[model samples]
Target: MTETFHEFVVQRSPALSRTAYLLTGDHQLAEDLVQTALARTYRHWRRIRDGDPEAYVRRVMYHQQVSWWRRRRLAERLEAEPTERAGGDHTDTTALRLTLTAALRHLTPRQRAVIVLRYYEDRTEAQVADLLGCSLGTVKRHAHDALRRLRAVAPDLLDATAERSTR
Candidate 1:
């Protein structure tokens, strides 16, 4: 039996939010992206009920984010106040995540999206190209450029082992 839109959202939102967060690199923007995507999905739910609604919503979010990025070429505003968190012992992981996030911010929106989809989402180049409505060559170029930029911006985060082996 097919699930209701609300049920589908409840089941899928957390994962979607994580993807959105990775794409936007800001909690608030991620929330907005998910919300906007869900809203659009809700509108088309009846028609898409029998199909892959989640994929539809994700595509909407991607396109919407890219549109927003194109329209606003201004620098992304960082959070003014850091939220308090329950202390954890994962300092190394936290530091690495922060470093990666900073490096991603240096990339263009399309490049960042390519990295997030290709690496974070673990999608193949063809899958990413399909999702982003771009060609395979475009995806490859973006991935190459994004990695090069990441290497320049945060060499430490790319591959410590490879760097060590070269040295």
Candidate 2:
């Protein structure tokens, strides 16, 4: 049996939330992104019920995010506040994640979206291009530029060891 919209949301929210979080890099913004996508999806649920509603919602989110970024000409910048640590449990992985987040912030929304789709979401270049409504060459350019920017911003994240080996 096909699932209801509410049931679909309940079952898929966590995965959607994670994707939104990766796209926006803020918990609150991620929640808002997911909510906005879901609301749009809800409005057209009847027509899209037999189709891939999840893909439709994700496409809306990607387009919405890109449109907002274009209008704003910048992503939202949130200052990190100091927090009390319960113990000395911080590790290298935590530091790496922080660095990666900061690097992602430096990328343009389109570049970041390409990176997320191509690498994080494990989508092919053609798939990303199709989803973003761009040509495959555009996807390749974005991926190249994003990687270049990321390498400049966080050399450690993009296979520094491989570079060293080649050199």
Candidate 3:
């Protein structure tokens, strides 16, 4: 609620939004995640203002996402696409985007979190473990399984050697 907090929100909201989208794989859910995280951050502004508030917000978002995953039954039917393109990453082709999205859909919440935190956020395995509050071995296991599933679902995503010049 302070001026600095407002500035922090303005500065970090875009990156937070992108990460939220990657985490939820749904635009509306991502927006809600970011909003909830920011609200939590605001509540703890006095305590975390001197520290890395963004990290705190991200941690909150991740925890909230897990709880949401728990509440929602995984048996829900799959839709062709969750939402229109988030329009955040223009470099990736639509085919690759859709394939990756579908591939991600095949993963559990933890596996998806590992993949997103490690690759999209460029977090180290140890960091991912810490973020998810799991052992390093668990993080590695989730990552391995997630990649295996990604490979089975969308092999092209794993084969980086191929040239994808969609020009």
| Best-fitting candidate, scored by lDDT | 1
Q: Write the per-residue lDDT of candidate 3 for residues 20-137, one digit (tens) a residue.
A: 8877777788899999999988998999999989989988898888888898832333576545656656555766776687778788878888998999999999998898899999
CA shift of 39, model 3, Å: 0.9
lDDT of 1 at 11: 94
- For each candidate in turn, the TM-score is 0.85, 0.84, 0.85
lDDT of 2 by residue, 1-167 (tens): 23699888998899888888778877787898899999989889999978988888888888878887888844589444323357744775565666677788778778888998988889999999989999999999999998998898778866644544676
Task: Tell me model 1's lDDT, rounded to 2 decimals.
Answer: 0.84
Expressed as tens digits, the lDDT of each residue in 1-167 for candidate 1 is: 23588799899999999988888888899999999999888888889989998889988988888999889943486543334467854565675677777778788788988898888889999998999999999999999999998899888886753544677
Q: RMSD of model 2, in Å?
A: 4.1
Q: Which sections of candidate 1 miss by over 4 Å?
A: 1-3, 73-75, 78-90, 160-167
The reply for model 2, stretches above 4 Å from the true place, is: 1-3, 73-75, 78-89, 159-167
Pairwise TM-score winner, candidates 2 and 3:
3
Q: Which is better, 1 or 2, measured by lDDT?
A: 1
- What lDDT would each prediction earn against the true structure? 0.84, 0.81, 0.83
Clashing pairs in 3: none
Which 10 residues in a row give candidate 3 its minimum summed lDDT?
73-82
Number of clashing residue pairs in every model?
Answer: 0, 0, 0
